[model samples]
Target: MENYKIPDNLAVSEEGFLFLPATGESFTLNEIGKIVIGLLKNGSSIEEIIERLTEEFDVDEHTAEKDVNDFLTQLKNFRLVEEI
Candidate 1:
């Protein structure tokens, strides 16, 4: 476990909309990715995050763990998150 930063130029609207820059290319997020980002924005720990997702999404602990780890790895590779 590491912490990550939410991209400053992007945000979620009050209405729960994803806001990306007009000049930036649009990137669609999947269901799990959306939940991960939501928890990350809320300052949840990696372990807490996986726990939350597992409970909220009706996913098994093992599946949630694997998905979150893989998702974080991809986000890091894309520069969407930097270790903190």
Candidate 2:
């Protein structure tokens, strides 16, 4: 995967929140999203992301799987993330 190419229109707002521009929608992220995005910026792997999230959020594996998939899907749908 091309690690450097984060979606052009995706950015953290002034209040440090993620925003997806294509849909004119805003996402007020919890700490998990913030940390995940930071890791993504540093080219972290999906596996690494899962590990970090699980450690930080105290969520079980199954719940983490579902939430990560759902979040990534939404990002993909809005073109806020690219698979590379």
Candidate 3:
């Protein structure tokens, strides 16, 4: 699992709206996305996030890992997170 950092200029609303101060771009996140982003911002490792997801969402480990990986890839593609 890799560590990632959310950009310092990014702002996340309580309702899961993500805004980039640098580019003035905004995006919305689903509930799961919100949780993942929150955990990532808190410095949680990918594995730790998987564990938390499984415990919180009634999802299996495999599903959680896959989902997290996919979400991380999307974040990377969007330039919202950087590998640390």
- Which has the greatest lDDT? 3
User: Residue by residue across 1-84, what tens digits does model 2's lDDT show?
Assistant: 223235767877545577766777776766666766777777787777888878877798778867877877766775666786
Residue-level lDDT tens digits of model 1 in 1-84: 677766777655544455557445445577667777877887787899889887888889999888888988887765666566
lDDT (10s digit) by residue, model 3, range 27-72: 9999999999999899999999999999998899999999999988
Residue 84 shift from truth in candidate 1, angstroms? 1.5
The residue pairs found clashing in candidate 1 are none
> By lDDT, is 1 or 2 better?
1
Error of 1 at 14 (Å): 7.4
Q: Which candidate would rank higher by TM-score, 1 or 2?
A: 1
Give each model's whole-structure lDDT. 0.74, 0.70, 0.93
Q: If the candidates were sorted by their TM-score against the true structure, best first, what order would they fall in?
A: 3, 1, 2
TM-score of each candidate structure, all chains considered together: 0.74, 0.70, 0.96
Model 3 spans with C-alpha error above 4 angstroms? none
